[model samples]
Target: MDPALSLDSRVATLSLAGMALAWSVGLTILSIAATGAWEPRVWAVALLATATIVVARETAPLRAPFTAQAHLVVHVLACTAYLLYTNGSEGSAASRWLPWIPIALSLLIVAMCRYRPPREILGAGLLSTSAIALATMPLVAAPMPLHGAPGGALVLTAVLPVMTASVAAACYSRILVANSERWKAQAGYSSAALEPALLSDIERVMYRERVNALSGEAFPFLRRVLDADSISAADRDTARDIAARIRSAMVHEVDRTWLQAAVDSGPTGVHAPVVDDPDACAPMMSGTQRAALRTLISSLGASPRLDRFTISIRATDGTCRGEVWARFRAPYRPPRRRRNADLAVLRVAFSEVTVSTPADQLIVRFSFDHA
Candidate 1:
């Protein structure tokens, strides 16, 4: 696994464990005080239940598809079971309302899970109103208890656990957000470092095309002479076979007249226009150069957002300097040279390649030196 993903998993697990610990400890303390029996027997039993829950929570991390929702359900059930066993409707003020405290904490967990929902504000308002209504029910429905006395202390103890649990839930959410941002930043940096390598590879393919056009032998033994140390066997075979044939076939037929035939001609299968063009402008283009631009434009078709594309070459002045232009629509990235075989070919035909964007328009202009 990637280091970033591993770190995020660990942070998420710790956050869930923290919430579980806060809830378990709060309930344990409240239960001991309300019953007024540090009697070794009952106190030990309550502590044991808290320990069991804390340990169980660690094994069930929050990422098992439905695990988070299931864990919440288990936590809610544990709270209900603990309250019912320790202080069922004994009509005792301390134990009678203990169940509601955990109920409020469970609701806190649910609200945390839906932090960015559109109804979060409304849901929270409703929850706060519900907790107030539920907590005050005992006082309103029954006789008043004396203030600043044992009964008042018991009431405060029941509410304190719910309040502390809310704070812990909020803290857990902030930590999760921070960790997510950290992972995204790391991934972005790694992607940027590979861009230069891709550009260099494109340059290598363009030169290979020129070498192939000059050799009658379909495969060049030139790979060993150029970079025997770093070149792989598979790449050497492809380079030699493809470049030698290209050189032998294209060297004699390529010239100014041959290029003009392509410009005046319509749809020779060598150029696929992104937009319909009756008179293609790339008349002075060499066969390898035309092949290159065609490759670049065809690859753009794979990108769903790239609606239309065009590359036209025009000669200017007495010297047949070629200009290639292309436009790609929004929500698409420029074709990478190494990946788009066509652009790699066209690039060798020109001395310089310039890309520009003004407003929503994307332009790629290729400049050929005087020839």
Candidate 2:
């Protein structure tokens, strides 16, 4: 799976866990403070325990599927159980509206649709709507008096939010999908303007290094050959051989492309080998992407905690995929602010970027088109 998608799943899982924790805590406090039947309080405690267990299991270090269906099932059941217990137990207007709490909670599920597939999102919406409808059936049949309002009206009031929230979720999911496509399109168009500047900067740096190399090695060798006045045939041949070798070296140095030079000069402890197969040639990344990759490499090299790092890139079918693996000398948690800043830049440059921390290892995987 794409690393970006995995990160998104983790984020969604954590968010759901946090929500469940908050809901459980709040429910427990409310049960303690409010004068309610012992049965409802017991049920709330049981539900809270279940929620805690689910969260612990889901948020474990090991990767596991965090399904939208599971989320809807747990929360909907908890909310329904609470509503069933609370309804008609109190005469306050608030008590009559207790059924709406579950619908409101559904919004959290809706918000998470960003991380889910369209079909999953649609399924969750339908499940939530059905759960809300089924949970409120008792109230609809019993016709609970709320300031003399009809039971149907009261049911509609609760149902409307669920319907509205479902529509909103669909719209939000569509927007997220559209924005992702738009960004890729923008990156493709913008790459043309950006590539030259990146290439020029890289060339300038390489040129300076080449100049230094010529002054230190090639020029001195040639000067020695020129200074020798009395030279035998053997000596002249040796000089000619040295001159040819020097010329060849200079030509090779000059012929090295900007990308090759940059890759060769990458920070210590990072290895990017040249893959000879045509299918394995690195894709032509946009200037922005190259810049982002350079920045990320620099940041990783500068980190005192990182002991070793390796990155590999390969291209196939017009797409370039890269993987970065870093090992820490000790357990290290990267500074969130700096890491996020780098990732944000990378996310803009690449179509997808994923970062994973497992035990003492950090893995970053990303892919982008040739553009």
Candidate 3:
């Protein structure tokens, strides 16, 4: 899977988990208001159901099918309980509509469709239909005559909308899955088609840079060697040394503009510290990774108390490791929320990142594969 798409899935999963938690809280509040008493069992069930769904969402990548199945089962059971309780209670004909509330909440299944298979969506729809039918069975069997309306009318009125929505959602799920697959196929094709052009452009740039560098370093020496009437042994040795140096420099040539920009743009009050490894070449980083590093530097610069900061980077064997260390004039403490948000952005780009604060110095270390 594409890393961007995988990150999006994680974000969606977290959003759904948050929605489930909010729904559970709302249900609990409604129950308490309607009954004028706290129901521990209801609260326990609600929390457990929400927590189970959240855990399943968090672990969905491990076993998507099983997670979807578990989510469907939990939703069905929870909605069934709500339906049964509301239907069994004594209330006006208007109360027949109350059971549909839980059924409506089941629409969250639509969101799940994005990540679940067609079979799972179908199974969920079927199970939901059955559960709704079973919940309304009492009304079907009892045939209560209220406000000149038949019990069958009440059951149908309540069930039809839920069933229709479930079916529509199922169909929509298929469409969504098809569209997603198509989009992914097109993305793959586009990437494949552009690879050669991108590589050609990179090769051209590197070639140009190398040519410029060679001219700048060796042109003077070459001109002198040619201008001299008779080149001495020392001059020949000097030419050889110059050639060796140029080759060595070319082997490690890399752009250092990003590093300079990062340092120069440090917070207004903070002293701009030098790169830890002044001679080390900048690692080739993706746009996403560079953006992440930019954000990290900005965050470090944001703290008013930070008086000094240093950035260190090392690349070896197709991997690059970087560290940022900041020192504050006063006893500085980082805010957890802000720190976490910054780290989240880094983690999206880098393979691994860690932060530590020992005393007043804040240190962040991250690594990524340059290859």
Candidate 4:
């Protein structure tokens, strides 16, 4: 699957999971409120169930599929007990009013789940409000010993909304912070992966320019091909094909720019093919070849100027033998004696960095003697 598509799927799944959790909690709370009264034990259990669910909203117990589902089950069971204790009647004033507290509390949990609030804040809010909501029940319900206490009206009207909304705000704030962290991580990965490849390509081009700076001729059509203006598909294909062919043509020339482009365009990541074929060149290469290859690719991949240029190294007998191919972008000149000197040094380092270009294909090969 495409990376972008995979990311979209994950986002959708998280959203659905969050919504389902909220709905389940809300329904349980409503069911409890519809009951008129309940036995002392049953009421206790019902309050416990609500507390369990609300507190676990984003915690390990709540986030895990099995644990969350179990909490919801408990919520429903407690609500059922509340209804049974009340004799299945919904009209009683005590019953009609009791539902408001749990419902509001549940709504707060739902909101936090959807928004993915901070774990610490969510836990604290759930625990604190559950304490308040459960306490309010006896004050409003019958059976004076455990009922008709104090502050029943205030708990229902003012406190519930305020507490729930506070939880919601905390949840929203947490979500934003989490998202910001993810963005920073992604940005770091992109930089570490792509920058090196770009810099590697650029360094190779610069090295070649240094050698040939005295005198060289630039390719005529290179600039037009790289220009950003819109063009037909066919033209684009044609341009790519031509550049590819040019890259192929220069394979025997041992040009740094062309080789750099080839390596940079292949793949990007902290872990990637840095020196083209380090293994193939290993056996013949001295420390210098390895160092040069690493430096060359790193500089080119990080640099904009070398991105469009091509670099090719063809090796024979584990050393640079025949040709080094480089296709410079248009308006960039090739150096005069630079070519000869590069060829000679590459030949001298033949065992370490041999360049070879066969009739039709260009290959960079290295080998390191493990023994």
Give the per-residue lDDT of model 1 (tens digit) for 136-211.
Answer: 4454344433232355554455545545555555455455557767887887788689778987886796567666
lDDT of each: 0.45, 0.61, 0.62, 0.43
Order the candidates by TM-score, highest first: 2, 3, 1, 4
Whose lDDT is greatest here?
Answer: 3
Stretches of candidate 1 exceeding 4 Å from the true structure: 1-68, 82-136, 139-156, 202-217, 220-371
Off by over 4 Å in 4: 1-371
Deviation in angstroms for 283 in model 1?
Answer: 37
lDDT of 4 by residue, 7-71 (tens): 22334434433453454446445655554233443454455445444434323211222233343
Q: Score candidate 1 by TM-score against the native.
A: 0.34
* Tens digit per residue, CA lDDT, model 3, 27-120: 6567556654455536444643664465445334322223454655555555555564544444444332344344434545544545555666
| Candidate 3, lDDT over the whole model | 0.62
lDDT of 2: 0.61
Q: Write the per-residue lDDT of candidate 2 for residues 60-154, one digit (tens) a residue.
A: 32322344545555565556555655442444344424442554355455535555455556665666566666656665555445455666776
> After aligning candidate 3 to the native by TM-score, how far in Å is the CA of 12 from where it should be?
13
Best by TM-score: 2
Better by lDDT, candidate 3 or 2: 3
lDDT of 4 at 127: 54
